[model samples]
Target chain A: MTATDTHRTIEAIFRIERARLIARLVRMVRDVGLAEELAQDAFLTALSEWPRTGVPANPGAWLTATAKRRAIDLLRRDRMLARKHAEIGRDLSEEDDAGIAAIEAAMDDDVGDELLGLIFTACHPILSPDARVALTLRLIGGLTTDEIARAYLTSEATIAQRIVRAKKTLGKAGLSFEVPRGRERQERLSSVLEAVYLIFNEGYAATSGANLTRPALCAEAQRLGRILAGLAPDEPEVFGLLSLMEIQASRLAARIGPDGMPIPLTEQNRARWDRLLIRRGLSALERAEALGGADGPYALQAALAACHARANRVEATDWRRIAGLYDALRRVMPSPVVDLNRAVAHCMAFGPDAGLALLEELERNDDLRNYALLPAARGDFLLRAGCSAEAKLQFERAAALSRNEQERAFLLGRAKACSV
Target chain B: MRVMVFVKATEDSEAGVMPTTELFEAMGRFNEELIKAGVLLSGDGLKPSSQGKRVAFDGPSRTVIDGPFAETRELVAGYWVWEVKDIAEAVEWVKRCPNPMFGPSEIEIRPFYEMADFGDVVTPEIAEQFDRLREKTPAR
Candidate 1:
């Protein structure tokens, strides 16, 4: 291969190995920022050396070996004491300083657990949610600060500051590099899953970005979710989150019209939906359910999406089942969004009046006062109830409240049609 | 995107030789790594062409051909369907796989198509829809 080809190949190898390398590095160096820098140093070494070394047969292992060696050298230089090796790993201190740190010989097969530890660390609750998101993408997703900045539509310097602060926070915290057991595991895993899901939603339906959807972000989140599922295969919520993302991402192709208008689920071309993703999602849901997590918040949501996925057409959707799932979901998640979705499901399963009754109850509260969806959904139920004038007023209110240009236009069009 | 990863047939694989227990364990570890990376969608080994059949097609005719076809190196001993960011990612992952054959073997990666790939043939109107899902969550 040409030098350029070799460089690209090395880059690909680094992307795959970076996480595992840093995960292992943090366990030894005991600092997230220092470990990441050491990992980058190893990557630079590969770029300069791999083209001449012709890329090893097992490049991933070679990179890991190199990163560990570099990390040990850095520690030796900083500590100026070989005895500190007990904390770094004593087996390595016994070896000739010149020899590599295959040092943690016992950890050769335990990289998986180390990686899970890294995930938990990056998403630790101590950091702000934004900091956690930034750190996770940096340390685990193998993305540069600039890339994360562009992905989230923030300035590169801001992202850099967030990551630097996050690493310092983690450094001060001196968190253990092991997956917590029992209740702690459950809580930490949720943080990891939440961070991942947040990434997906930002991509799927970005709340702040100029573009409506950032497909790259969704793809990244999905990949993260899938990887998390593999790491913690026994965690039903991991699979549950995976299933939810896959099923939702499958609709991405059919979610928008050619004219840049958002396509609601009922009007999307069913044939356009990605069957492969749907199949992957359904199987993931099955895995989650098989693990007895059918009632988990994410699993319940996945079950709700599955009801629509199984239908070939809008009329064929299992509305009653969806309504029931929403009921169950509301019980666990109990948020304004879930309640609004539950209202829609009730409308779909029963009649317009039933939906209006729920909407009336919701309107009496201040929680959803500025939520455009409340007015939009109420307009739909009113229109179906033959209250066109009232529905038109609601639609106009919804259109005014919406920040999305396309959605605002769509809502206004609905309002205009109400006069007919 | 999705790609088909073909583990080319080798002399031992063509002879219906089974992999040793050590090889099996190594391969299992490699597969587990792929799963953990979320690159593997599906994968399987074929029962050698000796147990398979092929049909050749002509203008309107078809002829059945028996197994153990020639060009052994051209035949696939196993394959994996992987979901990856690009062919580059696929190549890196493939490099990590254990030798599928008892002896030296080659592997190939080829990405397949989605409906969007045939843009001209499909609807030209459906363009850039990937960037148009309205924000569902309020800004944090």
Candidate 2:
């Protein structure tokens, strides 16, 4: 291969292996910032060596071995300093040989566990959401600070600052590089999942950006979710989260109009929904069910999305099944969002009157007072109930409450329709 | 992005030929890889054109056309819908697909247009808003 081709190949291989290397390094160094520095040192070493050497047979192991040696060398030097050794060496002792042996043994431990531990550490609840996002993208996704900045359309300096502060915060917290167990594990895992989903949504919808969606961010989150699922294959919630993301992502195309307006699922052209993502989602849902995660928060949501996916047309949708799922979802994860969605399912499954009854209760709930969808949904039910005047008022309110330009336009359009 | 992959029909497929056991197994393995990678959304093989019909529309009139359609090489013998990071990734996956026909065959990848594929509508203004929001909100 040409020098340039070799360079690109090394870059690709490093992107895939850097996380594993840092993950292993973090275990040894006990500091995320130091582990990343060591990992980059290995990458730089590879860049200098690989072109002339024409790449190794197993480059991942090669880079990893190189990084491990760097970690060990750094630890040894820190021990000589004594001051630097006080922090990391507290876990071991001044005996360099024994400490090196333990470090080597850990370096040889199951890589999956190490990778999982890395993800949890990056997404620990101690970090701010922004810090978690930046750290997760940097450590878990192996993206550069500049790349993360461009992805979020923030200044490179801002991203650089975020990364620096995140690392310092993590160091201050002194979080372990080992995956937590029992209740701690579940809570940490959810934090990890939440961070991943936040990234996905920000990419999928660009909550506060000029961009409606950044497909790259969504794809990146999907990669993270896939990696998480692989690392923790036994965690049904992981599969459930993956399933929900896959299914929702399938609608990325059909969910929007060529004019850049958001399209509701009922009005979307179902033919545009990606069949492969839906199939993958369904099978994942099956996996979740098989793993007894059928009632998982994400699993139930996936099941609800699956209801729409399984139908060829909106009329054919099994509304009753969806309502049943929302009921179960509400029972387990009671939220105004779930309750509002339950009302929607009831409207579709039963009659507008039944939906109106539910909406009546939701209206008194302060949590949803400013939520546009509640009024929009109410308008939908009222319109169906042949109360167009009230429906028009509700749609107008919904349109006023909506912050999105396209959604407001759509809601106003609905209000206009109600007038006729 | 979502992409549609078409496995163009070969002469063998046009004759309603079935895949050999080995070929079928190989294709199955390839499909398993796609599914497990969460790339393959849904896909299926098609019957020969002899079993198909088409309805052509022009203005207010419609014409019912029956099989077997001409241009067998242009016919689709199978297709898959996949969600991929990009078209290049889809290309890599397709390159790994086992030959669909007993002989040489062709696979085509077409990515579904996203909102970004439309005009440059995504503005930097909203991103600035997001930055402001991020600064105001503490970590959740």
Candidate 3:
């Protein structure tokens, strides 16, 4: 392959394996920050060396081995050689075919668990929400701080500081790098699932970018969810999270028009949806339900997704079921967003008037003051209720508050249609 | 054993932005669970790093770093100290925490040393001073 091809190939590999690579390193060094640095160092080495030596057959393994070597070198430079060498010295010294085999064996054994530990550590509650998201995207999603900043519509300097502070906090607290267990496991699991969901959501919605969606982010989040499901198969919430992401991701192909404009779910082409992902999502939802997770927030959300999935057309969707699920979700974890969504379902199932009543209740909510969706939902209800004049005003207001260009355009279109 | 559960800082967190009421309620519920489980000794959130200072020692001189430190991987956002039977027991409790960042974040757990571990080297006077200092400080 040409040098450019090699570079692209390496970047692809790193993107795919970045989380696993960092996870393994964090396990070996017991430091998320250090592990990420070493992983980057290995990537840099690959960028320079692969052009000359050509890409290796097993690039992930090659990266792991190279990173391990770099870590050993770092330990030596830090003058902490004796301490680590004592633990694994004899294995490193064999040098011949036997040593190589032993080293490979050790690497293979250590890498998987370490990656899981890294995920758990990154999602730990000790870190601030911003720090957790920033660190996870960087280490697990394999995104650069600049890329993350762009994805989140934040400044690079801000993101950089968030990550640095996150690591420092972990180190200062002397947090261990390990998969939590027992009761603590249950607590941290939600955080882990949320982190993965946030990654997927950013990709699905592209918080702040010219593009409506970043397929790469979506893919990475789905992959992480799958890994989490595998690691915690018995956790209903894990399957629920996986189900939610997969089902949402299945609609990616239909979420955008040919002109790159946003396409609302009701207007999306069901035929274009990924059947395979829907199947996977249904299977995960089934697992979640079987594990007594029907009431969990994620499971409830997945069930809502399933309602859409089960429909042959927008009109056929079981809006009543979705509304019921939202009611259950509200009972468990109430929020204005959920209430807004519930209003949408109520509108579809009952009538626009019913939905408008709910929206009116939410109107007085201080939390919805800056939330664009409240007015947007209210406008939709008003339009459906034949109150075009009020609907037009609400749509105009929603258009003003919306950050997404496509969303703004769509809302403006609705406003114009209302005027007619 | 004295243990520290570290809460890492983030941009939103450093801004002194409090979690939404919904989040606070959820976290409060979770904290209640921790207390009921007998794993929580004391815990609280921290002010932004901009409000804090870090002092590093080089020989006899101390270099102080201001909040919103340049390196993110080195700041302390908040922490909790608990008395647990052992590290394994502590790990068991940490697993149950809700997602720290409903939007984006991480939490870290570290072990703290006890007076018994210091042995006879720490005099009663020094230990008393340490105890007094710890008592005056609030858990983060």
Give DockQ per model, in order: 0.29, 0.05, 0.01
Screening candidate 2 with a backbone cut-off below 3 angstroms (N, C-alpha, C), the clashing residue pairs are: A209-B126, A209-B127, A210-B126, A275-B41, A275-B42, A276-B40, A276-B41, A276-B42, A277-B41
Q: Which is superior by TM-score, 1 or 3?
A: 1
| Residue A150 lDDT, candidate 1, scale 0-100 | 85
For residues A15-108, write the lDDT of model 1, one tens digit per residue. 7888998888878767888888888888899888878878887776777778877766665665547466456654545454533344465237
Candidate 2 ranges with C-alpha deviation above 4 Å: A83-94, A207-213, A367-372, A397-409, B1-140
State the TM-score for model 2.
0.75
- For candidate 3 chain A, the 10 contiguous residues with the lowest summed lDDT are A91-100
Give the DockQ of candidate 3: 0.01
Candidate 2 structure quality by residue, lDDT tens digits, B36-86: 444565688999999999999999999999998999889999999876655
* Candidate 2 lDDT tens digits, A24-122: 889988899989998899999999998888778777788888887877787777766876635653744558778889888988987778988999999
- lDDT, model 1, position A330: 84
Error of 2 at A36 (Å): 1.0
Candidate 1 regions exceeding 4 Å error are A81-109, A206-213, A369-371, A387-390, A396-408, B10-18, B48-56, B60-72, B119-140
Give the per-residue lDDT of model 3 (tens digit) for A128-219: 76688888878776678888887777889999999998988888887768778899888888888878888888788853335533666777
After TM-score superposition, the amount by which residue A71's alpha carbon in candidate 1 deviates from its true location, in angstroms, is: 3.0
